[model samples]
Target: MYRLKQMNTLRNQIFLGFMLVMLIVLGCVGFFTYGQVSVLLRNNAEKHIQQTAVQAAGKLDVLLRQVDTFTAQVATSATIQRLMAQEAEGEKTTFAERQSMLQEIRKHEAYTTGIRSLELYTTDYRMLFPLTDVSLNSRVPQEWINEADAGMGRLVWLGLDPRNPDVVIAIRNVRLIDHSFSYAGYLMVQVEKNYFEFSVEGESADNGSGEMMGLFDGAGKLVTSDFPEGADVEGMLHSGAKTIELNGSTYMPIQKRSEATGWRIIILTPVNYAAEGISVLRTVVVVSVIIGGGLFLVMTFILSTMITRPILNLIKVMRGAKLGTLKPISVPSSAMEINELNNTYNQMVDSLNELIEVVYQKEIVQSRTELKALQAQINPHFLFNTLEAFYWALEEKGEEELAEIVVAMSGLFRYVIAKTDGDEWVTVGDELDHAERYLKIMDMRMVDRLSWSIEADEECRGAPVPKLLVQPLVENAILHGVEQRLGRGTVLLRATPSDRPGYTRIEVTDNGPGMDDEKLLALRCSLEKGLNSRSEGGNGVGLANVQKRLMLYVPGGEGLTVHSSEGQGTTVSFEIPNAHKGEVES
Candidate 1:
């Protein structure tokens, strides 16, 4: 039952439904936003890598062109040519010629820092001048000479040297100035690896960025890399793919090949680093969603409460109206619709109260009028004078029992009819006296078959009750109970101070044949049905009449309670306020 009620509340329904929609909306927006940000970051990273590769490749090209230009100047020099001719002719060069050739080459090397050493070789593959470095032997290989001669005086990039892998070597063929253009010798220039590193490092430093750069030869051999130990340079260069994954990290490789040097500049940028902002963005999005959802829930609770509070209050008032309580809504709501509804309910309550007031006044007037008409049926003065004559005549003949019967009958009729000009209220003591007079007549009629007792607490004796209230029950007791039974019957009437403050309890019990469940139910139903309903023939009319009159006197009262079974007697009871003077007047 608790679960059922929880499921049905308007607040829960609205709050839950709104939260569900919020979650879906936030989830979709966050998901798509995070995806787009990740893509944008990756694309920007790739573009940066491409830019770095381009700048590095351009610098390498410029450096290699500078080396080629320097080599060309040396090859065209008169001193270097005359020396190469001396070496070609198998002549022992003079010290001055040797000093002049060495001075000229050393002079060019001093202008640029990239050149480590320069060697001039003859057509027979013999170096004319060699440096003291062990890697610079006074010999040239057949393949190196053939490769240089094939360039026809143009520069040829030989990549890493076999003797010293750390040095890059380039060669140019020296030729005669005449149209014959005969080969004089070859000029081999050795460049330190630091020159390439300088260009790449300069570009990276300008951008305040750090990434792995590898220079690869046309043959796909790795020349130099910034961090060669940490990466797979050869594998990445030969993979033929734009991206590489190594050590559990994905990297995007941007490659630019230098046309002059036939060298590839490969820059590897880790994809995760480029997308680092995505992680922060994801955290922000989640927190925003949670905070937004929490605020929405609070607002939903407050709004739903505002909407449902007045309706619940109206329901409570309506439930009270079922038990004859009518009250207007005293407080208004912030919402116009709910306020209007409350106003309408209050208007309905006013209209219903007015209708009930009209009906109740009419009923009171009709009840009094009918009561007066019934009282008029017997001429009070004539009946009273006749009973007086009979009472005196019987007493004169020394018949005391007959005289007493006449006196009781005259008192009963006087008590009932005497209040026709006044309100229908009487003290409990007076109603009990009237009931005793009626019971005495009933005892004379039933003789040995009837017996009764009338009792009242001292505090209840002066309590007000409607006129003729107790007598009807006494009459009903004698007629339906004592008269119907063959054996002797007993009837008891009791009035006591009620447990409730300023109220009294009255009971009428009779012992006779009693009633079966069906008959008892019908009798109780008749009492509940009120005066308009026809009662079953067995004492129902009198019992219903007494119940109806009690309710009329005490509006909204539970008129009577009947307790009965097959062989047990029946007891009927009612409670009345001790003070009913204002109630009767109104």
Candidate 2:
């Protein structure tokens, strides 16, 4: 199995595919060439052996015909016939006459060099001359005698001589050339085994090493063979010319039959003799393939690297960009497509950087402008209303309480206007103090009709809260809820730790003529909908501005909430996150 992380690279895949194809092509060519060369070598060897056998068979046939012609000449001689006729009549013959006849017969004995010995026998199986202790009738096998008698003056092969197993002989019935064609006796010509050997003497001289040659008679009997030890003679005789393996050696057998002699000639040549050149060719092909494969691998490696190097470089740059390093990439490459891709990436990065800078500057300027506008709106309305009330108290009431109201009003303005460096949050204590100051001024204006109280938990006093967030709600409660009533009303402000962690709850309540469900619903909807200072109502921009500030500064959307009932009190509350923990002294 192949893995993506291992050989899944495009370069590796292409290299592997190329190598596979080369191997297949080389393997196919090598196999085909080897097979063809083997076949050619084998066929050449077969043809050579077959031609040699044909030549040997032709020579053997000529030798046998010469022997037969010599035998016929001896059989038709008049001198031998007169002697045989005289012997058949049982006539006494003188020693001198017998010696002359013997001399005449000896003249024909040297007719052929292939004949080892020649003998004549009478019809009664008696040798006429050149007598030996062995009788012709007793020495000859019955089968040979039967074949000689059946020949009726024709030459006949008698196979191997019974008296001398290594000798082969031809026999014929000798007859007188008379009107009756009377049989005189039998003439036998015996030849040594070397006579047959001379027939195939130079025929197998060119045969290669580990070659075996054999001759078999018509009945499939082994007449002679030059096969080495461990040769399977019986197996060879049973089978035709084909390849065989024996004793760990491979052989190709060639067999040919002679039409003249009814003899089979077989040759077994080792296969390796013909395969020697093929082995050398195989070695050359293998070496060439290996060297070519090595060169191909090296070239492929270089080419693949050339293709993938630029891609890897681009990937490295992309990784840097992923880590927030938006910088231009300048990878140089020979390929036009890669160069164009890098240029496009650089352009995109430049555009993005410019866009980020423009957006950041615009946001900073807008935030400052909005904060300044809010400040301007709060300063004029709050200071003017408080100063007018203070002036009225000084003119109409005594200066005893007016001085206190002026003092509180001065402290409230000082707290609001005193800017802290880079600090957007104020403590809950400071916010409650600002609200108390505003209530004090309003108390003086309402006199007996307005009563107000401010309460805050010590734990919540130090809670950091948005500036001017609570004071506006208290002013609205007094002016709208309590001041509108016919009877004296009470205004209350409270700040305490809320049930939610990391937050403080601030509520402003007024006991006066509370609104109906419709008015309360409308106010609640306006708070939830996120009021802005541009909004106009009985509460003017104060309530909306506080809600907007809370929404912007707080973590969640818990800005402001209002609850009221007819003939009951009205309460407005909101929660501030991170406003419950500070440097508060217990």
Candidate 3:
């Protein structure tokens, strides 16, 4: 009896612990699952509603466009053109005469076939034609007629027609080629309101059951609904045209809009159908756990619980470790089985982290060495020799020649040393000054063989560029490319400021021997793949460096382009933003 009482106490403790855990876990899982599903459905439904509204609005805009196009065609017709031409010739039209003329035009097959009704109003904003008496009561408010006259080239909605009560679209326009030929009149087209209502009705709304669709305006007015026509719409109408709600009993209310007509379409479905599987998913999670608990304990027999518990811990630890998350693993141990498992895990984690740290340090050192090697490739030795030659010439010359040589040397050395200071982009003036220096050196070598021009819209001069960017191309042209040709060769640089609204453009053109088609193709390929060693070692090293530097600061690196043809000439151009334009700073 004493042993049985002790066992009962142990059993009660285990039962209480399991009940507390189940309550906490179920709360997290059930609420999380409900929240996620609700959010997804709500977001999807709103997007669909907005898209539907946009499509309907677009269709309405198209109808308006159609009205504008037809009005334009009639306004330019030979008959109407001739009538306007006569009015310019000083022929006065009488009321009876104007009435007869308008009636004749209205009866014509072309006008009668396409238009529901037509009106021609005067410059003073008075109705002048289509008079009921053919001689009286045709005059209308001058302001209304003048409003139509002002709307030429555009379709203006004019509410309902006073006579026939149809929707009217109107335009007021006068065309004149020379000084004298001008006419004032408004063209109006009456459209049936039912036509618009019927077009929207084409959308299929019913989705089985007793469900239906509806439409409302922004003012909470029920325009047309799939529900019974005369029924009160207070329950269905919403102030804003876009919201979804559950209707009384079995319905899922989904609302959308026709932006063109400013009409809303709401659809409803039975809620019973949607909720059917929700309960089942909830039950499966809770009931399956309750039923399997006894069988699970029996099969495990104290072994599976011990093993599974540690595996779960290992899973938690590795997930954090892989993400470089600094969290330690801690799990309970009932006996030596779990205690040994915990010790083994900690050793493996420590060893793995140490190896990773060692590899990372080695990579950092190697990367620094490669960067230094790239810098050493562009030597200052080439510029020094050219500057020495220029100094001797300047010592024996006048102020003009001395000024020329000084400018040349300054430009050359600026570009040579520019690579070390950190900024990628320099002012346009700085780049152009660098180009002038490069040109001066080549000018000495080629004497009268080469000529160049740099013309930029004064507004464009403040644009930016990669440092030393313009010099390498000038070198490539004078050395391996264009300046080597025998004929009189020329290079031109031009820049235009963007009143074009997005980017700045600079262009450089050369009239020396341009690359054949094959060379241009190879250049494009090499650039995309980061250039080959043989290519980069040549002019490619400088070009690739220019390319890399530009990509860091400018969005589109490949925007640098060459336009050239075999036996013709080449134009290499690039564009970057002008920081002074107030678009981007630095």
Per-model C-alpha lDDT, please? 0.78, 0.75, 0.58
Q: What is the C-alpha lDDT profile of model 3 across 357-461, one tens digit per residue?
A: 989998999999999987775566566656666766676675566657666776677566645444556777777777877787677677888788877777677
C-alpha lDDT of candidate 1 relative to the true structure: 0.78
Q: Highest TM-score: which candidate?
A: 2
Which rank order by TM-score, best down to worst? 2, 1, 3
The lDDT ranking, best first, is: 1, 2, 3
Q: Candidate 3 — which residues are off by over 4 angstroms?
A: 1-282, 289-407, 418-421, 479-481, 515-522, 525-537, 540-545, 556-558, 580-586
lDDT of 2 by residue, 1-586 (tens): 5575766877787677777887788778877887888788767766766776677667667777887888888778777777777777776445665566567766776666757777877787777654543556786877778878887888886666766868877888888876366887888888766676633435445553566667766656666677666677658546764578767788777677767556777766677875557778778778877887788778877887777778777787678668777888677878898898999989999999999999999999999999998788777568757776786778576785776787777777777676656456788988888888888888888889888888898988888887778888887887778877898999889988889887788999998789999988887777777655332245444777888777677645577878889989899899876533333222
Span of ten consecutive residues with least summed lDDT in model 1? 131-140
Summed over model 1, clashes come to 0
Cα lDDT tens digits for candidate 1, 1-586: 9999868887788878888998899889989998998889878877777887778887788888889889888887777776776666668666666667788988887778778888866666555666332222344455666777788889998778777888888888888664266777778888998777743556556654556788888778778887547677667657687677766767777778888767788887776667757889999999989998899889988988877787787677567656766788555667788778878888998999899989999999999999998878678888899999999999999999889999999998888667645557888898888888888887888678888899898899989888878777767666667677779999999999878788898888898678999988888887888744333355434777777787778987788888887777778788888886555423
**Clash number by candidate, in order:** 0, 0, 7
